[model samples]
Target chain A: MDNLFYAMIFIIFLTGFWIMLRQSNLIKKIIGMNIMESAIFLFLVAMGYVKEGSAPIATEANPGLAYVNPLPSALVLTGIVVSVSVTAFALGLTVRLYKHYGTMDVDEITRMRSEEL
Target chain B: MITAHIMPLTILLPLVGAYLILLVGSKHRSFARNFGLLTTGITFAMVCYITYLVSNQGKMAYYLGGWAPPLGIELRADPITAFLLLTFAGVSFFVLLFAYDILPGEINGKVITRYYALYLVLLGSLLGIVLSNDFFNIYVFLEISSIAAAALVAVNGDKLAMEASIKYLVMSTLGSGTVLMGIAGLYMVTGYLSLDFLAGALPQAYASHPLTVLMTLGMLTVGIAVKAALFPLHVWLPDAHGSAPTSSSAILSGLVVKVYIAVLLKLLYRVFPLDFLAALPLQGSLLVMATLGIFIGSIMAIRQRDIKKMLAYSTVAQIGYVFLGIGLFSEKAMLGAVYHVFSHAVMKSMLFLSAGLLIKYSGKRTIADLSGLGRVYPIPMIAFSVGALSMVGVPPLAGFMSKWYLGLGALEANQLLFLLVLLLSSLLNGFYYMPIVIGGFFKKETVEIRQEKIPLGAQISLLVLIAATFFFGLFSNIPISFLTPTVQGIFSAFGGGI
Candidate 1:
């Protein structure tokens, strides 16, 4: 079951990378990047999972039962926040780029930019 | 001692300064510049005190949140950290002064406020970069530094500056992303993110998780090289540094990129096992890149019409000297690289700020406009000549001393090819700089115009830096002597091999 989950996430990562390489639109490329970042976050969270485990919190009952490692989960929260910040910043740049050049295509921006420089 | 709180102050002063500027600077256009300078002045004094402490104590390591190393994030002040901190503060303070004198009122006040905010943030992040003892935390600071730095580059809001800054933003983000992935891989293998943990787990990880360890190391090495602008990955640097506002230009070329290089040095020398590095392909590849960067940067500089662009390109070649020395893999060579790091930081900032002032007053951007500048702005022109001479490695100047040691280090290791590269690059330095100096003095000022005296603050800072350009170069024994024992200490950890 763990292996299957890992495979699914790996597939998602590969697809995201492919889209990132293939996409011409800046927004799509950004989405692809977000997808890849999500996959990595998934991988990190999965590292802390355990079979038949409850949340890694203290309680009076079930003191001896298995629980997930909490550290990687905590780390993933930080990673997720960083991903969100980058995504937002990239979006703002996209808006500005469109306003300046009137296009969302990366190639068009590059072409217009080269002539401008 | 009654007070050891200065360690945290080094980081805090800048943070407060950055935030204070953001808070009050927008409304009071009158107060922003002076407030920023006072904050920077306080930070500079703190840095000087830290240096004083290190010079006496031999080393200072402070743990955050009351946890010791291997668990808590450590901020260690070794000689290198202290050296870099002083450079960052010194350069930023002077650049801010220069900025005050020359900032065109045409540029919006709010934009100028944002510039100070980001500049202080960059300075604080650079301090964090130098002092960090944990791998993942260093990456966190690197992200902050580069993002703020990229934003500062484009703060001018011009088309070219915007393009360059955005390009820098992308490449730098990519590099940080790759480095973070490598850190994740390392964490997965060793269950640790601290440098001490990485060091202890290395033998076990190398034996059991060779593939994981190798991949992590390779990713990180290349990522840092990318950030440091080692030859091939350097395309974004010249553009970003060339097009940014002059003060930003000073910080970018002077210390920001070098701080990244220091991060890489810390990564490779302190964390990665020396034996693994020796067996890897990365060192040889770095040598090739340094060789190329030196020659290519020099050739490109010779062709630059814009004076600042030429200086930016010259930085590419100058930085190549540091990489080459590091690649030599000898203690002397590493020490040489480290020494150049300090000397180059001070000298380059001076050159950039002086160029900035010249461009501001004269509105002339090209090398030819510099023709007969010696007649108009004699003080700044002389300052420029000093910086250019130091760059050309003339005797008794800071540049020559770094080159002399680096050249000797190459020969000490019997790396004659790198030696040849250094020699040729020095010649190339002269090729680019001599023309400007000769022209500044020899060629006649074309137009009859009023000779504007530089603002007092700008004039005073330039004088101090000029005096320093001579002092750090000629005095020789003061700074250089302190560095040797630190190198010896780190070298002993490697069994005194290099």
Candidate 2:
């Protein structure tokens, strides 16, 4: 069951990467990057989880309870911050590209630039 | 005790200098440039200090926040880290000085301060990547440097800079993401993030979970290869490096790409066990691919018309030489790669800075447009010629020495084909470079050109770098000696064999 879950996440990651590489629209490509980041986040969080494990926090009610690993969840928070910053920067670039070329399609932009060259 | 402070200070001082520059620079334009100069200069001094200490003490490691082990982070410096720090600080000081004159014209006056700030931040993050003693911290610093580098590329705010920056950002983010996933995989398997602990734990992890180990190695190497622009994954490099400002072109081509290679070296040498690396077909495959990169990149350079684009393609070829050193996996080869990193950093940055000056003064971007221009701008033209010859592996020059050592390593490893590749690539290097030198100095002028006065800072930095190119070539023993212990340590870890 665990193997299946991990395999599905890997497939999602590959699909997102394919979209990022294949899509012509800059916005969709950024979205694909975000999706890929999301898959990694899911993989990390899943790595931390354990069967029948409770919250990682300490409590008197569950003194002897098995707690899931917490480090990956903490690390994912940093990953999310990095992802958000990259997305914001990419969007800013896209706005500039649109203003300069009047198009969001990457192929069109490349064609326009080469024609100028 | 003072030595313990050196590592943290090296990383933090530039960061503090950046903020101070930001605060002071917004008010006065000239202050920012001086502040940047002062910051990098001091950082270089500190680098010298640490190199002295490391030579005396062997290897130094410091615990951050007064904590130890898997809980608190550490900063460590062996011969490899210290040598690279010295190179990083030295090259950055010169590049920052060069930027003082070039950037104002390339970027708007208002945001010029911000550009200096980003440069320092990038420098600091690069230092962090080199010195950080753990895996996750390396990831954090890698992202910080990548984002700063992208911002520096986009500083011009033009259509080309914007496009290139976005392309760089997307590809690098993908690379860093894969790297993070690899680190996470390692962490999950071993429950450790410290490189020392990971090295100890990895061999056992490989025994129990070979598939995961393989995946981790694949993802990590691929991610780093993308960042380093190794061969086929190098599509983003020419556009980004060519379109960026000259200082940026110099820094990115000369240092940024090389930093990733340094990180990959540390990982391969330190974290991954030798048996695991030998078990996989990774080294041999990289050797073949890198050989192809050497050939393909040179052929591409010969086709380029734009001067900056030609240099960018040449950078791709030079990086192939670095990877070839890594693939050889012998001490001599690794030492040659390290020397190549230093020499190339000096020569390539000199080429870019001088090229930027010519483009500014002569208003020429293509090689044909630059015909007979060397007669007018003697200083920059001479620097360009020196750099070109050194790059072509002329006798008594830096590039020649590196190629010699790499050839020796190929012989040691019994890989004669690579030695042939090295010789052929040098011939290819001359094919592209000689024409430019010949056209610049020998060809008669076709068009009347207005020569602008070169900035003092730009002139001084270019001369210094050109001198360094010759110095490293003639005195190759200095770097070779410095790298010997580090390479020996790596071999000793693998039980001290060829």
Candidate 3:
């Protein structure tokens, strides 16, 4: 059961990787990057999982109760911020590229650029 | 004592300076250049102080917020760190000095403020990468530097630069994601984010979950290799470096790519046990990839028509030398690798700055158009010749010293083939670099040449870099001796110390 969860995460990660490598549209490529980052975020969050653990808040009444690790959750916050910034930056570049080339297709852009050269 | 705070201040001063520039320079444009220069200059002083302290006192570690590791972040500096910090701080100051006159011309006037802001942020984050002793801290700084660097490349706001910046961003993001996943895997097995704690826990973790440990190592290696532009992963580098402004090219090719290698060295030595590294096929694979990168990158460089693009490809080949040194695993080879970091940083930045000047004065970007440039612009052409000779491993130049050490290292490891690779690559380097020097000086003018007065600031910057190239080569013993103990300390576990 534990292994199955990991296998699913691996599959999702590969799916994102494939999208990044195979996508022709610039927007789709950014989406692929996001998916890939999301998978890693999930993997990190899942690593801190304690089965049946409650939220990692201390309560006097439940002082001895199991609580999930809070560190990976904190790290995932930073990771998400980084991912968003990269996405924002990539989109900005794509907008500039589209304005110049008048297309969102990577292959088309390459052809146009080469033609200009 | 006061020294304890200096490390964090080295990083924060630049970060604060970056924002300060954005605030003030937005209103008053001229302030950006002077203030940026001041910030980098002061930061360089602090790094020098830190180097002095480390050399006398040995490795130093400071805990953030007075909390020890496994709970709080740690920043550590050893001999290797100090050496690299000096290289980064020194080279960046000179590059900024060179940029003072040239940048306003290359980039749009309005974006100049933003360019300085991004440049400082990139420097700050690069320092953070070298100083931070935790996995997550390095990752965060890595992303920051990556973003700042990408922005610098696109600061020209041209069609080609925009496209190049996007490609660099996408590929580097993939690298970052892989690195983060590797960190997560390490955390899963060891429950530690601190490198020291991770190192202590890793052997035990490996004992219980061998496959996970191996996978984590593989992930980290791949991620760092991509960022460092090792071998097959360097597809995005030429476009980005070629399209960036001159100073941007110098910083990106010279310092930024090398910082990732610093992180990799720290990880391989500090976080992983040496014997375990030896037991794997890691060194063999690194050696193979580096050899391929050396030959292929040089071959590609020879085919480039654009001078900047050719230099970018040359950077790819130079990086292979550093990796080759690391893969040799002998103490001297590691020293050569580390020294190459400094030598290449100085020589490459000099080449780019001089190239930028030649292109600016001649109004040409192709190698063929550089003919008769030496007579028209003697300073930049002379600087370029020095850089070229250094790159070709001419005796008593910076590049020769590093290659000599690397060759000696290869022989020490009984890998004579790489020594041959070292020699052949030098010949390959000569093949590409010699033509420019020859053509610039000896060939008759193909087109009318106009002489324009070179800026005093650019002249001073180029002269300083030229001097530094000669300095590092002649006084090579100083840094090599300084780095020896640390390299030995790292290889102590392998047990055959020099």
Per-prediction TM-score, chain B alone: 0.96, 0.97, 0.98
Off by over 4 Å in 1: A1-25, A50-54, A58-66, A113-117, B104-106, B446-450, B495-498
What C-alpha lDDT do the candidate models reach, one value each? 0.80, 0.87, 0.92
Could you give the C-alpha RMSD of every candidate to the true structure, in order shown?
2.7, 2.0, 1.7
Q: What tens digits encode model 1's per-residue C-alpha lDDT throughout B399-443?
A: 778888888888887888787888888888889998888988899
Return whichever of 2 and 3 wins on TM-score: 3
DockQ of each: 0.36, 0.72, 0.88
Ten contiguous residues minimizing lDDT sum, candidate 1 chain B: B489-498
- Sort the predicted structures by DockQ, highest score first: 3, 2, 1
Return whichever of 1 and 2 wins on TM-score. 2
A43-99: candidate 1 lDDT, tens digit per residue: 778877787799988988878789997767876787777667667766777777778
Q: For candidate 2, give the lDDT.
A: 0.87
Better of 2 and 3 by lDDT: 3
1 versus 3: better DockQ goes to: 3
Off by over 4 Å in 2: A51-65, B495-498
Docking class of 2: medium
